[model samples]
Target: MPFQGRVVDIAVDEVDLGAAGVVRREYTNHPGSVIVVALDDDGNVLLLRQYRHPVGAFLWELPAGLLDIDGEDPHIAAARELAEEADVRAARWDVLVDLLPSPGGSNEATRVFLARDLTPVPEPERHTREAEEADMVAVPVPLEEAAALALAGHLHNGPTVSGILAAVIGRANSWRTLRPVTSPWEYRRN
Candidate 1:
């Protein structure tokens, strides 16, 4: 490891490509993560407006979290993020999409789940927010509007845009493209 941080590690390695000969490469090793595209009955996607220090701006994004807890299922992680970030729980869950956001530079595999059958978490049971999340604002935007914003470059967060577009495609297909929540996650080493 060239450098190790709390959430990620930067690694430098030597690689051999038969045709190109040996080469050096550097990349980030991530713990993987799960994203929840929670949809209400009205077809509005739950989004959170939170400050991103790196960007120095608040961006709307789906409920998501890293799979940091050892042995925790991705499905459970998705559910936990939905509840913690959106104060809601979803009874219906399906795999919408899986992606490597930056394959060339990072091993950050993310699984986006389609969540429906929503119910609010009682106030007494809600998770207490902290840091940037403490000031996050939850907003529900219609699928079409979200897609438009994403296409317009207004929603710049990578996973948020991906999840929104995937939801749009899934909806168009009557959600037939969605896989079972327990579907195998090929990108995840765990």
Candidate 2:
């Protein structure tokens, strides 16, 4: 009754938590990660189409990945993933949101970043060690288009959709705050 759940078993990449109460617990312990909602100069959001085995489907999502084993910084991981997954790098980055995908079961925390001032990286690193190759494809869609897709249930991936909306709203608010005020002499006739 003292919260006595110890890791009874450990695998190469996961740990099994022995029963503490009425349930057996297992977790895939992963280093915290970052997701990048990269924006190109044309005001297009970058997305990737990748196959997710658990879902048995290919879905469109923002570029994301786990942190390096050596405990790399999340912001650096975001830039690294952007290059690795989409072959693009950004000159600017803003932290839009932080999320826990499943806090009750896992320790994975994902930081969502908004990347801008895009540039092409000379070479992108692919995860060759993964069981299945991640076929990375870059799709540039307008913010409005992404919002429409989300409303239509097409963009159902939680983090991806949330990142997109956060970026869109952040940009809108920034634009609204920075826009020049109209002069009384320049008022338009309705």
Candidate 3:
């Protein structure tokens, strides 16, 4: 173990900014994560009403997961999370937005993907979910409705809020302006 903590670590950096002199900065080190905006044919975006024990509420969030798998690409992790949590796959994917959820306190950057061309995973191949995920309720809300809720502050999840708003913008642009799924991500771990 690299010191202590779950899913994060305390890191300190000593740097000199020219005339600013030396400074010691402390922050949380995170492996980063990915959030998926899975849109189906009916223009509905899948959301998960997952209960968070720490928060004591069933937060509405997009399908997402930690980028902790050894050697897995960001896009791959996003896909896995979508299928595991939402029971679907995307034939098309693009980068919607990248977020630094808590830059002041942590280096936990996240990549949000706009996943379209949806297809259901066969029952035999469905993920065997456990923990909070097993009790997660999948809500397929219209994209416009989800966007409105997110903008209205009804959706409290950071990634979901940012991703839904960004996805709305991406759709207006006909998805041409979005980056490829394989585009380089600063937080990507090789």
Candidate 4:
């Protein structure tokens, strides 16, 4: 069987699809791209609280954007978004996870990255059409606390929460491989 879909309508930001044997038309959106869940040296997760016009509410989310073009790699876009949104640059980067914001209707994919050894960079001039004049604070929360907040539904942003979870688990697994050190009392015992 071949999977086929037809575009019923096209717009600047979204498209409606009518697939074979499907009852309702599915909405496919070009959300561009995003990068989220960056960590600083102190094991703190960074987040941004910004207002979204579509939702008519201020939402806390990880830094992310749609791809400027089709051929652009998601990793590069992630790095750029991290710098732009948070004004921080990372010396090390790893892809923690890739997420589909809404699998049922939209094609929006969010790439979460674990960034370390961060250094402050000058803020880039805003190019977005939306007004972003409010102070954008880079609040650092402890990894464990952040995870708890996410679990309790206080942190509603999916990508941001997922990124933090991935980083915490990855760091724990990495630490498990290290050799244990002898205590000072052990030397006296010998």
Can you give the TM-score per candidate against the true fold? 0.97, 0.73, 0.92, 0.72
Which residue pairs in model 2 clash with each other? none
Candidate 4 least-lDDT 10 residues: 181-190
lDDT of 4 by residue, 1-190 (tens): 1233342222233234555443544555444355666788788888888887766777777677666545666666777777777777788766676667665766566656667789877545543333652555567888888888889888777777777777778788983422211112111101
In model 1, which residue pairs have backbone atoms overlapping below 3 Å? none
Q: Is candidate 1 or candidate 4 better by TM-score?
A: 1
Q: Among these predicted structures, which one has the highest lDDT?
A: 1
As for TM-score, the candidate ahead, 3 or 4, is 3
- Model 3 agreement with the true structure over 1-190: per-residue lDDT tens digits: 2355777788888889989999988888888999999988888999999988888988999999998888898899999999999999999989998888988888899999999999989999999999888987678999999989987889999989999989888889898769988787776444
List per-candidate RMSD values in Å: 0.8, 12.3, 1.8, 12.7
- Candidate 2 residue spans exceeding 4 A from truth: 1-28, 123-134, 175-190
Superposed Cα deviation of residue 183, candidate 4 (Å): 41
Off by over 4 Å in 3: 1-3, 187-190
lDDT of 1 by residue, 1-190 (tens): 9799999999898999999999999999999999989999999999899888988898889999998999998999999999999999999999999999999999899999999999999999999999999977679999999999999999998999999999999999999999997888888867
What does candidate 2 score on TM? 0.73
lDDT of 2 by residue, 1-190 (tens): 2232332122132334556434444554545667888988888999888888889988889998876546566677788888878888899877776677666656566778888899887653443324443556789999778878887899867889888888778888883422111212121111
Sorted by lDDT (best first), the order is 1, 3, 2, 4
Native-to-model Cα distance after best TM-score fit, residue 29 in candidate 2, in Å? 3.2
Report the candidate with higher lDDT, 3 versus 4.
3
In model 4, what are the clashing residue pairs, if there are any?
32-66, 32-67, 33-65, 33-66, 33-67, 34-64, 34-65
